[model samples]
Target: MSHSPVHPQLRLYFENPVGRLLEHPDGYLVVQYNAGKRKLEELKTFLTQASTLLQQRNWHKLLGDQRVMAAFTEAERVWITENWLTRSTTAHPYYGAVLLAHDVFARLAMNLVMNEARESGLVYRLFEDENAAVAWLLQVP
Candidate 1:
């Protein structure tokens, strides 16, 4: 996504080659992935940072804007599921509102990961718009 002006209510947390991680005033993490492929190391770093932030704040909601993100490689997917998601879910049954990627391959990759997340007890929903995703996240108690 373009690094357009950030919403006044959002706090820019971290911006890496992979994405921009923001903190919403209402208490959640907002990760807007850039429109490009990500190296495995970069992806791992970004997720580790996000998880750290989540644990520090005890936040349970995340808005993942993956509309322009490229597809994840098999290795990346495995690391995410085995390393990041498991750690995050064990800490809290977090709620995630994901805006699906425009690329069909990216969407498919995300779906596979999300399905695993569901089985792990995460409550999540997919959306095609940011407003709807944010609204759904806010409504989640």
Candidate 2:
């Protein structure tokens, strides 16, 4: 596995090429991926910023909107599950609801994340629709 230093701009959270790190009024953050496959470095930066936002906002949950997300490589999945997702596992416990798009590759990656999250004791659910995902996340802490 290999990783490069992500662009500094990705650290900004709210505005980035891959997605926007948004806070919802209802509580929790939204990591909405853009309409293209993101490089491993970009995803890493997104997660790094996301982790910071999670801690800063004292939020325990997140909503992942994958409507425009692109396929993640096998190595990327491993990195995310072992490095990123494991790091995301907090003592307070994080909850997440990931909305899967029609993209098969994207769904597969989401499933990988979902499985890894469950193993790491994070409460998470996969959704085929946004409304249901929001509903699930609303019930989380």
Q: Total clashing residue pairs per candidate?
A: 0, 0
What TM-score do all the candidates reach, one by one?
Answer: 0.94, 0.84
Against the reference, the lDDT scores of all candidates come to 0.87, 0.76
Q: Which stretches of candidate 1 lie over 4 Å from their true place?
A: 1-5
What are the per-residue Cα lDDT tens digits for candidate 2 across 17-98? Answer: 6677877767688887777666788778887888888999889888877776787779778888888778876788888888
Give the worst 10-residue stretch by lDDT in candidate 1.
Answer: 1-10
Whole-model alpha-carbon lDDT for candidate 1 = 0.87
TM-score leader: 1
RMSD of 1: 1.5
Which residue ranges in model 2 land beyond 4 Å of their true spot? 1-13
Model 2: which residue pairs collide? Answer: none
lDDT of 2: 0.76
Top candidate, metric lDDT: 1
Q: Candidate 1, residues 27-84: lDDT per residue as tens digits?
A: 9999889988788998899999898888888899999988888998899999988988
Residue 5 in model 2: shift from native, Å?
A: 32
